[model samples]
Target: MTEPVSISLTVNGATHDLVVAPRKTLADVLREDLGLTGTHVGCEHGVCGACTILIDGAPARACLTYAVQMEGHELTTIEAVAKSGELTPLQRALTQVHGLQCGFCTPGIVLTFEVWLRDNPDPDEAGVREALSGNICRCTGYQNIVKAVLAAAAEMRRGAGA
Candidate 1:
C-alpha cells in the first residue's frame, strides 16, 4: 500500500484539500473525492478525450494527470461550464444542432471547445474539425458537432459585440 499524500487542488474555482494516493489520476480524484463526475473516464490511456479538462486554462486529459501534479494548477471541469445554471452558447448550440447522442463524449467535447472557442472566436469548418479531432464520438458523425461549433462561434462573436 502506498502512503496517502495530502494535496490541494483548485477545481472549478474552488480549492479542495484532500489526501489521495500519489498514483491516483486527477480524473479519479475529481470524480471520487470531489464529486465532480462531469469529467468522464473513457480509455484511461489518454487516447480518448473523454477525460478532458482544463489545467491552467488548457485542455488536458485528467486520466493522464496525477492528482498530486495538479497541486498548484487551476483545473476546470464540465461542471464549471454552466455554473450559472444556464447553458453556455456552446451548450445551447450543441443541443440545438443535436451535436451529441450518447453524451459520453459531450463533456469532453464541450470542455475542449469552450477553451478553443475562446482562442478561436472566428474558426472555420476546417479549424473546428481539427480542434474536435481529439474527441471521439460513436454516436454523431460530427456533422452536427461541427455545425454547432460554428454556430456557437458566430453567436459568441455577436454576443461579444453586444
Candidate 2:
C-alpha cells in the first residue's frame, strides 16, 4: 500500500488539512475526508460529469482529479455556490423553471452552469444547451435545465448575480 499524502487546501472558503492515499480521487477526498458530499459518483470515471467541482474557478471532474494534485488550490463545491445564505440567480432560476427532478445531478449542473454563466451571462437558449451538454441529468430531460440556464442568464444580466 502506498503512504497517505498530506494536503492543505481551501474548500468553500475554509482551509482543510487532510491525509489521503495517493490513489484517492478528489471526489473521495471531498466526500470522505472533507465531509463534503455534494460531489456525487455516478460512473466513477469522468464521463458522467456527476462529480464536477470548481478548482480555481474552472470546472473539473472531481472523480478524475487526484486529491494530492489539489494541494494549495482553491476548491468550491455546491455547498459554496450560494453566498450569505442566498441562492444564486441560477439556483433561483432553476427552482422557478423546475430545472431539477431527482436532484442527484443538480450539484454538478449547478457548478457547470456557474462556470458557464461567468463567460456567457447573456446566453441564448442554444448557447445554454451547448454549455450543459457535458452535465448529464437523467431527470428533466434537459429542456427545463436549458430554460433555467437561459432564465438565469437573464436574471444575471439584470444585476441579480455576481
Candidate 3:
C-alpha cells in the first residue's frame, strides 16, 4: 500500500496542506480532492485544453502536473476567476455573447481569455482568434467566442481606466 504524501500548495491565493499520492495529477487534486470540478478532463495526454488551469498565472495542463510537484506553486482554477460574488468581465461577456453552449469548456475558455486580454487589451478580431486558437470549443463554433473575448477586452479596459 502506498502512503499519501503531504504537500502544501497555494490555490487562488489560498494555501492548503493536502495528502496526495505521488501519481495523482493536479487535475485529480483540483476536482476530486478540492471539489473544483470546473477543470475538465479530456485528452489527458495534454492535447486538449479542457484541463487547463493557471499555474502561477499561466495556463498549464493540470493532468500533466503531479500533485506533489505543485508544492509551493500558486494554482488558479475556475473558482478563483470570480471574486466578491462578481463574475470576471470575460465570464460575463461569454454569457452575454453566447460564447459557450455545452459549458464543458467554459472554465478553460474563461481563464485563457483572461490571460489573453491582459496582454492584448484591444485585440482585433484576427488577434482574438489567434490568441484563443489554443482552446477548443465545439459548441459555440468560435464566432461568438471571439466576439465575447473582444467585448470582454473592451469592458476590462474601460474598467481598468476608470
**Top candidate (TM-score):** 1
User: 82-162, model 2: which lDDT tens digit per residue?
Assistant: 867999989998999899999989999999999899888777888888778888888889999998888888888879544
**Mind giving the per-residue lDDT tens digits that candidate 3 earns over 1-162?**
378899998988988888998899999999998898999998788766888899989988898889899987889998887778798888888889888899988888788878878888888999988877777877778999998998898898899893
Task: Put down candidate 1 lDDT per residue, 83-107, tens digits, no spaces.
Answer: 8999999999999999999999999
Ranking by lDDT: 1, 2, 3
TM-score of candidate 1 to 2 decimals: 0.97
Give lDDT per model, in order: 0.95, 0.89, 0.87
In model 3, pairs of residues that clash are none
Candidate 2 whole-model C-alpha lDDT, 0 to 1: 0.89
The C-alpha stretches of model 3 lying farther than 4 A from their native spots are 1-3
Superposed on all Cα atoms, the candidates' RMSDs to the truth, in angstroms, are 1.2, 1.8, 1.8
Per-candidate TM-scores read: 0.97, 0.95, 0.92
lDDT against true structure, model 3:
0.87
C-alpha lDDT of residue 5 in model 3: 96
Model 1 weakest 10-residue run by lDDT? 39-48
* lDDT of candidate 3 at residue 4, scale 0 to 100: 87
Model 3 lDDT, residue 62, Cα: 95
Model 2 ranges off by over 4 Å: 160-162
